[model samples]
Target: MRLVQVAQHADDLERAAAFYSALLGSEPTAVFDPPGLLFFDLGGVRLLLDRNAPTAVHYLYVDDLAAAIERIGDRAEVIGPPHRIFTHEDSTLGPAGHDEWQAFVRDSEGNTVGLVSFRAVA
Candidate 1:
């Protein structure tokens, strides 16, 4: 089956909505008042933000490596900046290989979220 949606908990609906909007480059299109839930359109997927006691780890894969890092707002904690890692190396030919960018960030509840981007190079 295809992956559809992912959710994360939040204590404050407004704060969570703002954080997620800035980080993911999307805004909440709908909200349920009874449960106090906020939904965001994550590309073709959906992200549910529910008002819970605490948050959880949410991992997102993005194509724009540089833009994602820059979009992370001040309130969100940056565990690491976007950096490239060599997966395979051609030792005989020198440093030539595919690279991937990985970085982590912690949300309000200390949930560590990871972002990765893979790029092929010669």
Candidate 2:
């Protein structure tokens, strides 16, 4: 079966929306304010931000880890600087011959978010 949705807690929907929009490079797909719910399309997967949901640590794939971090700028706090995490020798979890890089940041509502990317080894 394929994954559908992932929910994360947000104390302030508007602030969360702004931070995510910038990081995702797109506006939210849908937002319901009365019950406090927000959605973003992650290539068909729903990323739900709710007022009452428990906080979750989610990782997002980026084309360029450094570029993504730069785009985030002061919008979020960079808790972990970008660094290489692994070098794939075979196509098991990631592309073979590429290096996996990751970094961490705190979102607007205080959720830890991980940013990941893969780059070919030089």
Candidate 3:
């Protein structure tokens, strides 16, 4: 299936927009100011931030790890340092692989946003 966009709920639109702007390195492609939904382009994928609702455990993989972190450094609450997650056995469709650098963040509401970088497959 083709994945177009994933919504990450937020409590504050301006706050969330500011955070995402930093993380994405640009303003949202579109923003519904009333509903507080901001849209961002992530490589080929799209990300939608919902200001009224909060989502949890949302995983986002990006090509530029450091740049992503720097963008959201001051806006979102980052958990810890970046580390690789290897041997993800939950999915059998693939073999052993490195999870690459992973970090956590809590938005205005309480949704846990997971940013990750996948190691190149061997």
Computed on alpha carbons, the lDDT of every model, listed in order, comes to 0.73, 0.96, 0.71
- Most lDDT-accurate candidate: 2
Cα deviation of 13, candidate 3, in Å? 1.0
Question: Which scores greater on TM-score, model 1 or model 3?
Answer: 1
Task: Rank the models by TM-score, top first.
Answer: 2, 1, 3
Q: So what's the TM-score on candidate 1?
A: 0.74
Q: What does candidate 2's lDDT look like per residue over 1-122, in tens digits?
A: 99999999999999999999999999999999989999999999999999999999999999998889888789899999999999999999999999999999999999999999999999
Residue by residue across 1-122, what tens digits does model 1's lDDT show?
97787777777778877777777777798889678788888777878877763456666878876677678667578887778755546545223475667788876545677887766775
Give, for candidate 2, the lowest lDDT window spanning 10 residues: 65-74
Please, what are the lDDT tens digits per residue for candidate 3 over residues 1-122?
99887877877777777877776667888888785777888876878878655475777766766778776766667775677666455456333454566777775556777887766545
Error of 3 at 73 (Å): 2.6
**TM-score: which candidate is best?**
2
Count clashes in each candidate, considering only residues at least 3 apart in sequence or on different chains.
Answer: 0, 0, 3
Candidate 1 at 70: error in angstroms?
Answer: 2.5
> Which residue pairs clash within candidate 3?
10-51, 22-71, 85-99
Give the residue spans of candidate 3 off by over 4 A. Answer: 52-54, 64-67, 87-99, 119-122
